[model samples]
Structures are given as C-alpha cells and as structure tokens.
Target chain A: MLHLVLFLVFGAICVAGAINLLVQSHPISSALSLVVVMASLAVEYLLLGAEFVAAVQVIVYAGAVMVLFVFVIMLLNAGVEERTKGSRVALILGIPGVLAGGLLVAWVLIERTGTATVGLGALPGFPKTIGNLLFHDFLLPFEVTSVLVLIAIMGAVVLASRPEPKNPEKES
Target chain B: MLSLPIFLVASVVKIVLVIFILLTAVAYTVWLERKVVGHMQNRWGPSRVGPFGLLQPLADGVKFLLKEDLTPPHVYRPLFIAAPMIAVICALTSISVIPFGTAIPVAGHIIPLQITDLNIGLLVILGVTSIGVYGVALAGWSSNSKYSLLGGLRASAQMVSYEICLGLSLVGVLIVSGSFSLQQIVESQRGYFWGFIPKWNIFYGCQFVAFFIYLMAAYAETNRIPFDLPEAETELVAGYHTEYSAMKFAMFFMAEYANMITVACLATILFLGGGNGPLFGPPLLRLILPTFYFVAKVFVFLFTYIWVRGTLPRFRYDQLMAFGWKFLFPLAIANLVVTALVVAYRS
Candidate 1:
C-alpha cells in the first residue's frame, strides 16, 4: 500500500517535471526541470527494486549530463530565447497539429504496451546480478558500446584540433 | 517493509539521529580546523568563545542567524535560495548508507548502525554527492557577479573532473570486497591476515594507489586547499559563495564539511577497515569499540585535511585540470587494471 502511494506521488512529480521541462522559457529552468524529472524517475526505479539503475540514472543522467548542460548554458550566456510571432497559416493549423500529434503518440503507446501490470520488487537490481549479466551474457554488446564511445572521443578531438592560421593576430 | 507505522518510526528516528550527529560533527570540525590552522599560523584560535573555543560553533551559529540576510538586486532570487538547500541536502543524504558499526540489540530490537541498507550503497553515495555540483554551479551563476561566475565555473569543472577519478578509485576496492553494501564491506574486513596485520583493503589488496588517488580526488571534489581554485581568495575572492552572507554563507561551509565527513567515512570503510580493531574484550565492548574506531579514523582524516590545508599551496587552474585529467585519471585506470588482474589470479 505504501509502495503504491510512493509510486503514484513520484510518478506524478516525474510527469509534472517533464511538462515543466517543456514549458520553461529559460534554458536553466528547463535544465533544472529535467533534473527534477530524472530524480523522480530515479525514485520510481528504486521503488521498482532496480536500485542500481536508480543510482546510475541519477549519477550519469541527472548529475553528469545535466551539469554539463548547465555549464554550457552559463558559458554561452544563454537567456530566455526570444519569441517570434507565427504566421497566420500556422495559427489556423496549430490546433489540429497538436491534436493529431497527441493522438499518434497515444496510439503508438497503446499498441505497444500490454495491460500487464509490473509487480513491485519483482526484479531486484543488485550490483552482483547486474555485473554478472553484463559481463557474461551481454559482453559483446557492452564492449561494442565502449568502442563506439572511444571513436566518438577521437572524432571530437580530430574536429577540435585544427591547426592555427599562419597569422594568429588576423584570426583573432 | 514492516508494518508501515513501525518502518516510518524507525526510519524517522534513524534519520534524526544521523542528522544530529552529522551537524554536531560539522560544528566541531570547524573548531578543529580553526585551531589546527591557527596553531600552524602561530596564533591562538578562538579561545575567547568557550574552553578551547568549544562553544565557538554555537557562537558562530548565533551570529550568522542574527545577522541580516541580504539579496543583491542583480541576483536571481529562486536559484540563490535553492542552491544552498540543494548543497546541504545532497551532503546529508549520502549518510543514509554509511554504517557506523555492527548491529546491536537496543530495546530487544536488532538495530543496524545505518539508516537503511541498499545493495548499491556506495553507488548511492556517489550518485547523491554527484548532485552536489549543482549547488556550486547554480550558486555561482545566480550570484550575477563576475567573481562568482568564474569561481562557480572552476568549481563545477573541478568537481566533474575529480568525480571520475573518485569513482574509478573506488572500483578497485569494490573488486576486492565484491560488494557495494557498506555493511558487507566492513564484514569482509573483520579478520586479520597475518595475526598482526589487519586485512584492510589498503594492506591486503594493495589499494594504496587507489587510496591516494581517492584522497586527492576527494580534496578536489570538496574544493579543499590545493584543489580549491574555485575559492582562491587571491583570485576569485571567495568563489561561488562570495555574494552570500550570514546563514547563506554558513550553508556553503556546512556543505563543505559534510562532504569532507562523507569522504572520510568512505575512506575509513573502503581503505582503512572501518570499525575493525583488535578485539580482546567481551562482545558488548567489541560492539562499542568499533564505532569508536570508526569515529577515530574519520577524525584522523579530518585532521589530515586541516594539516594539508595548512601545508599545501593552491594549484593554478590549468595545473589543477592537467593534474586531474593527465595524472590522476591515468593513475586510477592503471591501478584498477592491476587490481583486477591480481584479484583474478588469486581467485
């Protein structure tokens, strides 16, 4: 009963935060709302017994990922993006666009997910079990993902490391 | 879970106790740091407050509380308020998983010396502390001053860099202990290998390299001396909290000390065989002594923190980044590989 209550509360917060993430005008506000969304999701993960996933979700997604976003926003001196008036044609199409988009998403979700309810504490995400699963059964996929990351790093370095122009003063 | 009310009662009680102890410890840590650094600088620090300035933290608290809390016109109001709360909350939340000692029978109930036990206890700490970076970052950005901006930038960057080293350094300990649960780690460290030498991770698993890296990373993570370029007085004038005053300023310091304590606790549990000591007495004494040993080890770390603050010079910004990325990162990786190989061979 208590778990159900916690799940509902955190679940509501997560949804509300996601909506806030979309609605906030300032980039910082959006970033903070996303962090809230991630955190509440982490709690939901914990209530589901996926403790390892919950921690990783917070550490990697909310902490590292969102911090970088905030850092870049600050570095770039981003304020609230300026609003532009939409054309009259878009105004006429806007209500239909929203309704159609919402219908499509709801349809896809309904088509994919079964009516089966996920039982609480059904899957305990103990670190030992996760380690075993990752290294033993999913080793190749994991190693491939790591290699992909390394390649991405190399690509970033190559892109960033352009030679200076002959006249540095002119470049400045 | 137990009967909902019982679980609530126990958890609430544990939370209150831990928070009380943690805040009190943070208070004394300020006193300890002042006295130690004062003596280092050839001064008698805070003797006016109470016996040896024992009540200095209390006096300081009163002063901060009584002072007028100010908000500059240029500063962002909501974020400025939220930042310190985030910092203090994240710092305190990690203590939920830190076990002080073995279980004891209290009022016919077997109570573990922790708020709650999670299988991913260590990971939980890492996750929670990782969130603390926001408090620093937001505090700086919201302050709407150049000094605060630069300080916040340096601080967030430094924290992000060292956090990798911090996490990597602990992987070696994780391998040796084969558990993320703090209680299990302590249990694994209970026995001695050579009858005299304790089977702590440092000695038995040869985790001294990881330990060193962890300590260095922790210093940066907490923005202490040598790693505290964010708050270099000569440079940023006080870093992220420069614009803050009164209790707001005190919150930042409180967060710092809390982080220090958390790191010290982790160091004890991971490297120093937390709460494990020579046991020659009765079971009751045995149970009580480990908590004492645990606290004593944490104190030593806190003392060393102050000692190093007095000794070392702050690293230049570029130097700090280079050291973390070029030096510590590679060292941590190397240590992890070697430890993995050794563990594999032994098994």
Candidate 2:
C-alpha cells in the first residue's frame, strides 16, 4: 500500500514536471523542470532495485548534462522576456507525434497485462549477476557502445574545429 | 501487533538519532574549521561566544534565522528556494549508508548503527555525492547573477571532471577488494602485509598511486583548497552563493562542510583499512576500537583540509581544469592498467 502511494506520487511529480517544461515561458525554467523529471526517474529506478543505474541517472543526467543545458541557456542570455510562440508547422506535426507516442505506450502496457510475477524474496546477488551478464553475454554490445562514444567525441571535435573564412584585411 | 509497533517506533527513533548526529556534526565542523584555521594562522579565533567559541555556530544559526530571507529581485524564485534544499538533502542523505559502529543487540533484536545498508553501498555514496553538484549549479543559475552563474558553471565542470578521476581511481580498489559493498571491503582488509604493516590499499604499492589520485580527486570533488576555484572569493565573490542570503546561504555552508566529512570518510574506508587497527581485542572492544580508528582517520583528513586552506592558494581556473583532465585523468587510467597487469601476473 505504501509503495503504491509513493509510486503514484513520484509518477505524478514526473508528469507534472514534463508539463511544467512544456508550458513554461522561459528556457531556464524548462531546464529546471527537466531536472525535476530526471530526479524522479532516478527515484523510480531506485525503487526498482537498480541502484547503480539510478545513481548514474542522477549523476550523468541531473548533475552533468542538465547543468550543461542550463549553462548554455544562461550563456545565450535566455530570459522570461525572450519567450517565442511555437511555430504553426511544429504545432501541427507535434499532434500526430504525441498521438503515436501515446498509442505505443498503451500497446506496451496491454502486452504486459498477465506476466508471471516473482514473489518478494531476498534481493538477487547483483554484482555477480551483472558481472556475468556484462562480461559473457553483453561484451560485444558493451564494446560497441564504447566505440560509439569515441566516434561521437571525434565528431564533436570536427564540428567545433571547422574554421571560418578569414577576412583578407584582418588576415594581413 | 505489539512487535510490529515496537519495531516501527524503534526505526523512527534510529532515523531521528542519525539525523541529529549529522546535524550536530555539521554544526561543530564549522567551529573546528575556524579554530583550526585560526591556530594555523597564528591567531585566536572565535574566543568570545562561549568556551573557546564553541557556541559560535549556534550564534551564527540564530543570526541566519533572524536575517531577512531575501530572493534576488529578478531571479527564478522557485528554483532558487529548491536549490539549497536539494544541496542540504543530498549532503545529508549520503550519511545514511555509513556504518558508524557494529550492531547492538537489544531485546533479542540486533539494530545496526546505519540507517540502510544496501549491497552496493559505495556506489550509492558516489551517486549521492555526484548529485550534490546540481545543488551548487542550480543555486548559481537560479540566482540570475553573473557571479553566481560563473560559480555554478565552474563548479559543475570541476566536479564532473574530477568525478571521472575519482571513479576511475576507485576502480583499482574495487577490483582488488572484489566487491562494491563497504562492509565487505573492510572485512577483506583484516590481515597484515610483510608480517607487520596493515594490508591497506596504500600498502599494495600500485594501489598507492590510485590512493593518491583518489585523494587529490576527492579534494577537487569537494571544492576544497587548490581546487576551490568554484568558490574563489577574490575572483568570483563567493561564487555560486554570492546572491544567496539568510538560511539559504547557510545551507550551502553546511553542505560544504558535510561534503568535506563525507569525502574524508570515503578516503578512510577506501585506502586506510577502514575500521582496522594493529591490536585486536575482544569482539565488543574490537568493534568500538575500529570505529574510533575510522573517526580518527577522518579527523586527520579534515585537519589536512584546514591546513591546506591556510597554506595553499587557490588554483587558477584553467590550471585546475588542465591538471584534472590533462594530468590526473591519464594518471588514473595508467594506474588502473598497471594494477590490472600486476594482479594478473601475480595470479
């Protein structure tokens, strides 16, 4: 009963935070709301017994990535008065996207309606289980993920380093 | 029915006790910092309030309580209020997993000193400490002041950069210890090396490098001196908390000291043979002694923080980043590789 109450409260907070982001006028306010969403997701992960994943979510998303977003927005001088109306084209396109997303979520929920359930028992030996899975079964995907991150870093550097055309007078 | 109610009441009491201990410790840490720094600088500090200025923190608390809680004129008010609260919460939450002493048996029930002891305890501590950066970053940004924003940005970058080193350095310890559980790590370090010296992480030769890197990275992670560019008073004007006032400002101060102690305790556990001592006594005495040893080790680290604050000047912001990324990052990676090689070869 307590778990159900806590889960609902957290779920509500996450949904409210997302809505707050959408309706908020300022980019900074939206970003702060996003932090709230990320934090509650972390709490949900903790409740699901994925403590390491929960920590990673908090550290990487809330601590590092969200801060980067806020820093960039601040640097761009985004403020309350700088709010702009949504483009008509985006508004029209977003309706279909939102509808599709809702349908997909509903389908997932429907598919999992009568799954086998594990009774509450001792928590599994997480370190040994995860280590075995990561090293033996998921090694290829793990290595590929590292390669992908490396490529992303290289791509960022390339994009950032492209030189602008020098003015002839300034060059001299 | 009676047992259930009694268990509930006892758990509630334990939670309250843990919180009270943490709050009191934070209060005294401020006083300790002042007295330590004063002594280091050849001056008497806080001698007026009461008994070597022991009550100075209480006086400061009252002052903060009485002061007008001001939000900056044009800041994001909701986030501004939430930021310090988040900081204090994250700071306090990490202490819940730390086992201060062995369990005591009462009414045929054993109650642990810690509030919760998850299997992945060390990871939880790391995760909680990492999230603390948000409190500093958000506080800086929400204030809508340039100084605060700059402080926030610097702090975020500094913490994120050092966290990489901190996490990597601990990989060596985790690999050697073969577990993420803090209790297991302590249990593994029971014996001696070379027939005398304790078999701590520092005594393991290669792990010594990792230990140093961990210590340095921890110093940066906590925003202590030489890495205190985030709060560099001369340049950033109190950094992230520049625009904060009253209890909101006090929250940041409290978080800083609490983080210092947290990092210190982590260091004690990771490298110093946590709760281990040379002389072994009876079971009850042995448990109490190790707890004392752990606290004593933490005090040394805390004193070192004060000593560094007095003796060393803050690093330039660019220098700090370069040292963390260009020097410590590669150093930690190399240490990991070397430790792995040594372990493999020995086995």
Docking class of 1: high
Please name the candidate that would achieve the greatest lDDT relative to the true structure.
1
Off by over 4 Å in 2: A81-97, A104-125, A162-172, B1-7, B279-284
lDDT of 1 by residue, B168-236 (tens): 999999999999999899888888887878999988665999999999999999999989888889978
Question: Could you tell me the lDDT of residue B181 within candidate 1?
Answer: 90
Lowest lDDT 10-residue stretch of candidate 1 chain B: B1-10
Top DockQ model:
1
Off by over 4 Å in 1: A87-113, A167-172, B1-6
Clashes of 2: 0
For model 2, residues B71-145, the per-residue Cα lDDT tens digits are 879887888998899899999888777766566666767776667667788888887887788798888888888
The residue pairs found clashing in candidate 1 are: none
